[model samples]
Target: MKKDSTMKRVLKLLKPYTGFIILSLIFALGTVISTLMIPVLEGRAVDHIIGKGKVDFSGLLFVLKEIAAVAAVTFFCQLFMNLINNHITYSVAKTLRQRAFERLLRVPVKVIDSESHGDIASRIVTDADSFTDGLLLGFTQLFTGIMTIAGTIIFMIRIRFTIALIVIAATPVSLLIAKFISGRTYRYFTQQSKDRGDLTEYIDERISLEDLVSQLGAGELSKEEFVKKNNKLTDSATKATFYSSLTNPSTRFVNAVIYAVVGVVGAFLAVAGSISVGELTSFLGYAREYARPFNEITGVITEMQNAMACAARIFEIIDQDQVEDCDGEFDGEVKGAVDMEHVDFSYVPEKPLITDLNVKVNPGEKVAIVGPTGAGKTTLINLLMRFYDVNAGSVKVDGRDIRTVSRNALRSRFGMVLQETFLFSGTIRDNLTLGKPDATDEEIIEASKAAHAHEFIRKLPDGYDTVLSPSGTLSQGQKQLLCIARLMLALPPMLILDEATSSIDTRTEMKIQDAFNKMMKGRTTFVVAHRLQTIRDADMILYMENGHVLEQGNHKELLAKNGYYAKLYRSQFMS
Candidate 1:
């Protein structure tokens, strides 16, 4: 959606808070009315003293008591309304944040890959937080300020209409100045948000690759790049701050001019005997009271516009198209037959990653895809998982198109173990039972034993309850073993092991291969690996080059053929 329309949509989310807004305005009206009474009562006290030789002490005391009572009531009303506004605001912010996070979870993997992790994180945290602040404080202040200004205007006119006209005349001029400054502030704020997202992306990229950066001696270059992004963010923030800060002092200057004009005109009317001394004094007090609301109104206008910019940014993310889930009833089970027929796929439109790909795996068969780097091995797995749809042709399991099945149901049928393993900050048991949440402690330990992880976990200080902090603790091979244990607990009907054993030492690899053989006994499995000896006994071996199948056969037959597969096997194992 366009930024303006997105902002309007965000405002619509606040419609449920209208009742609280009305109550706040009502409180503001009451407060403004009560404040007007003080000046009138003062004028009356002065008149009573001047009219008679003696002061009316009883009348004076009664007026003072009424003023105190009104003051106390007004204070409570403001406090109560503020508390309500805060509650309403917090509820709305919570709802918005929850929706944003849920949407992120449901979005397609392709959509996630298209944007940087840091950029998405910034939107969820920084942008949404700014939107919350603007929605609550900005909207409440704006509504109340408008009410106060309107109520003050009516009372000031009642006191002395001629002096009231001078204050009213300043309204248009104040609005014009506010409008001019708001345009600049809004543009600067938008730029600032974009720049901040860029800076966050840069930092995330650098930190994740810190070890590689140090190895390459690129520290100086990384620092220079970071400095450039930081400077851009600083410049944009400075411009936005400068423009937004102009609001207060500019409005104050205009108020000062209005005050001088009203004073001169009010004195002239008093001198001509058209107005009493008490009336003129009350009129000046009304003028000052009138300025207070107008100043508030101006400040609210400035703040709301600034908040609108933030709202626009937050809505932009919410407005983007998320992956549409295929509609169906699913029971999270599937027959293991797999097929890819005449499939063509691409991450970019102009460059095809896989072309005219045709492959099939019978139920309970073990197949290995052997390929060099960038030969579309992972892309094929991604397509089978429906992370990205094939540009042409179809992928099917048990004669049913994968796209026809709901994503969750289709994904639940398969387990995956990748080369690079990630262990979240938690107990070893917590990581093991992630997929099979309902599994018993016995089941978890059994799976861990099958993956050769239970013995090592038992050796830890806290055994299975040992907590692993992300920054310290586990070695790379140990993390891989934990992930394998997680996949074991899942026990899906089909599995994909993409270089799963490559990270471990040769001795550990042989141990894990024994576990893998046991796990694949009756399940369909797709193994993608660079090692020639890993898949020497597979049911079939597919040698792929530039997305095409170069050879296909059992390992011994392929080596006997003296073709591309033979050449590759000789280069590695026969060396």
Candidate 2:
């Protein structure tokens, strides 16, 4: 999108704060009005002493009193405006942050996977911060500069038209300089923001893969790559700052030249008797007044350009297409039956993954899906949860199509335990309540016990109240157990274990399996695992290969058939 259009959209986000914005404008106008009175009073005082050749003490005192009054009012106006502006800006930042986070929740899983974590984080934090700063300070300055210039010009013309004309004529030169620099600055800053996002993504990827890099002895190579990215970011930022910094100084220089010219002309006119000394003094004062705001106008333009660059990035995320949820109401509870007919799917259209596949699970049935790596095991679970819709065919829950039910209702029906566990930076109790926010302390302990995590949790100094940061104080298995405890508390009608025991030791896996057996009663279960031993007791087993079902039946039936399932079992058991 063009820069102007992007900025317009950002300004639209400020609609909710219109009251504060109006208050700011009123204060800004008051400030300018008060400032204008200072020069008028000074010019009058000069006229009384120099032109009249007499001093009126009372008149002098009156002018000084007026100047003092204007000064006081101006200060108060600025103070009030600043206070309101800060509040409005904070509100705007909060709204944008919430919208971005909610978008993440609604976006398709594929969309989230396609973007790097660091880039997304930068958009949320860095870009949003920039937008807030710009909207608050930039808007205030821009509005004040324009209003001051307008009011100052009117007053200058009323005092002396020729002098006003000179100032007006010089205005275009300053604008031209500002306009040229602002364009370049805006483009460079946009590039800088993009580079920053890239750098952030690179750092995030490396940090997350630190152990892998160490094991492969690629630390030096990674460091070199990081340096390269870092240098590019530095270069981009320098260029952006160079252009933006030039604008203010360049504006000031042009205004200085204009000031010299205006002063010389006004002095010549006063000596030649074309204008009085008092008028000339006032004109010169107005000229400087005019120049100051013009200088400010140029600076505001540069800042606005930079702010818009940030806003474009923030709005890009906000404007991304969101995943479509089911439109119909689904207030009733869901049965555990799930059926997929001739489902075909692919992350990219050019490379198909799951094709022409059909699967069905009866209510309260235990079904195990055994497949090799990249055989679409997790993809099936994602589809069932409506994280991504199938390219072809339909998924039905109970008797209704899944598409006819709201996403919240569909997802709320199942409890999922992924291989990689993620815990927030919070207390153990806080993390457990995520699955069921209203679960009581007693219920939380019960669920933890069921997942075999209660004993270990009790060993902690504060147990449920122990504070935990994201990067501190938990083993991988312990985190997984915490997630399991969460799932147990949810007590959904259906359960999905997607390689849930892949990270645990054999003994712990056996214990978790025993816990799973107890939890599986009266629940529809779908177990996706690489370990054949884990699924041997399932009521039904489906061996999948290249999106096709190669074998299906119980362990004994598949072994007697001596098909793909039997071969997979023999290979694992024989080892």
Candidate 3:
């Protein structure tokens, strides 16, 4: 995106706070006016002191008092301006983060799946902070700097037009220097921001899987990779800082030269009786004041460039294409009868994963999908849940096309338990009641008992109130049981269990299987299992390979046919 367009978008976000901004600008003007009066008052005081005996003590006292009063006003106005600027900067940052998060929630699942989770997080949290810092600089320094520069120019011209023109003529040198350095620094800062996000992503992944790395004896390899990413970030940051740092000194050098020329000319004018000594002193002060804004603004050029880069990244998320949702509403209850007609789907167009798939499941039947890795078992679940729309054909729930229904309405009918379980940082009761927030204590205990998780819960220090995190002490099997208990509490009409009991021991698995059998009695359930024995009672068992359902039947039926299903079953038990 072009820099001007990106900045325009950022300013649009600030439109809501226009009233605060106007008030701050008013305070800034007061600060500049009061500050400009100080130099003039000090010059008058200087005029009162001619010779040791000729000093006008009374006049000096009066001028000093006026300077003191103006200084106090300047301080208060500046304080209020700073307070308002802080409020606006942080508020804008808060709004940006909220919008980014909302956009993340609405974007297509594929968008999230394609990007690094940590990189997305960095754009929201880290990038937003950097942008706000730059914005604060703009509000605090840039606005006031412009006002001060203009005030000083007016004051200087009133004192001596010839020297004032000299100051004005040199303004372009400082601006040109700042512009040249700032332009070169932007690309480096952009690269630095990108590298920082990449490093953050790598670190997040490695830190989350540190245990796995240790177990697999890949610690050294992980460290080497991290070092490479870190070095890349370091290099980019070094180059960006080196270039941006030039703006301040380069502009300051030009301003210093202009100040020297003003001092020499003003001195000659005072000697030639063109201006009073006190007036010459005041003019020099105004010249210094004029140069100060340029120095300060150029000094902040680095932060401004970085802020633009980060803002661009944050807008990338806010501007993503959202998942298309239908406005059609479903009126009646979902009975869990599902059908997929001539379904075709693929992540990539050239590599089709599932094609010409047709399946019909009754309202309360248990269907078991058994397949090798990457055989599209999980894709089937994604389709049923409408996580991804099929390339061709439609999936129907209770004779109504699912694509016509709102996504939330369609998904509310099903419950899922996957092989990888998730437990947030909250109490056990909190995690259990996620699906049904209004569940009573008795209902919670009953569900926990059904999933065989109650016995272990009773032994914990706080039982249902025990806090759990993803890295909590609970074993994988324990977490899976908690997930199952959560589902039991909600008891949706349909269920999808993808290797749901894979982490448990055979004994505990058998107990959970009993609980599952009871739960599956009247609910339409789709089970993806690797253990053939666990799915023996399924009404229909699908043996899938390379996205095709090669054989499907009951235990005795498929065994009798001695086809693909039988061979897989024999290989599992017979081996």
* Best candidate (score: TM-score): 3
Write down the TM-score for model 2.
0.94
What ranges in model 3 sit over 4 Å off? Answer: none
Where's the lowest-lDDT run of ten residues in candidate 1? 326-335
Please give, for residues 402-439, the per-residue lDDT of candidate 2 as tens digits: 88878888888889999988889999999999879999
Question: Mind giving the per-residue lDDT tens digits that candidate 3 earns over 1-575?
Answer: 66777889999999999999999999999999998888898789889999879999999999999998999999999999999999999999999999999999989888999998888988999999999999999999898899999999999988888899999998998998899889888788788888988989998998889889999999999989989999999999999999988888888888889989988998999999999889988988888888889988986777888998899989999999988998776777677899989999999999999888889999999999987889889999989988889999889998899999899888878999999998899999999999999999999999999999999999999999998877899999999999999999999999999899988889988888898999998999999999889889999888888877888788889999999888888899998
TM-score of each: 0.93, 0.94, 0.98
Model 1: per-residue lDDT, tens digit, 72-164?
Answer: 877887787778778877777677777777877777787788887787777777877776676666645666566666766786788777778
Ten consecutive residues with minimal summed lDDT in candidate 3?
327-336
Name the candidate that leads on lDDT.
3
Candidate 2: clashing pairs of residues: none
Candidate 2 ranges beyond 4 A from true positions: 48-58, 273-278, 327-333
Q: Record all residue pairs in model 1 with backbone atoms less than 3 Å apart, i.e. clashing.
A: none
The 0-to-1 C-alpha lDDT of every candidate, in the order given, reads 0.80, 0.85, 0.91
In Å, residue 182's CA in model 3 sits off its true spot by 0.9
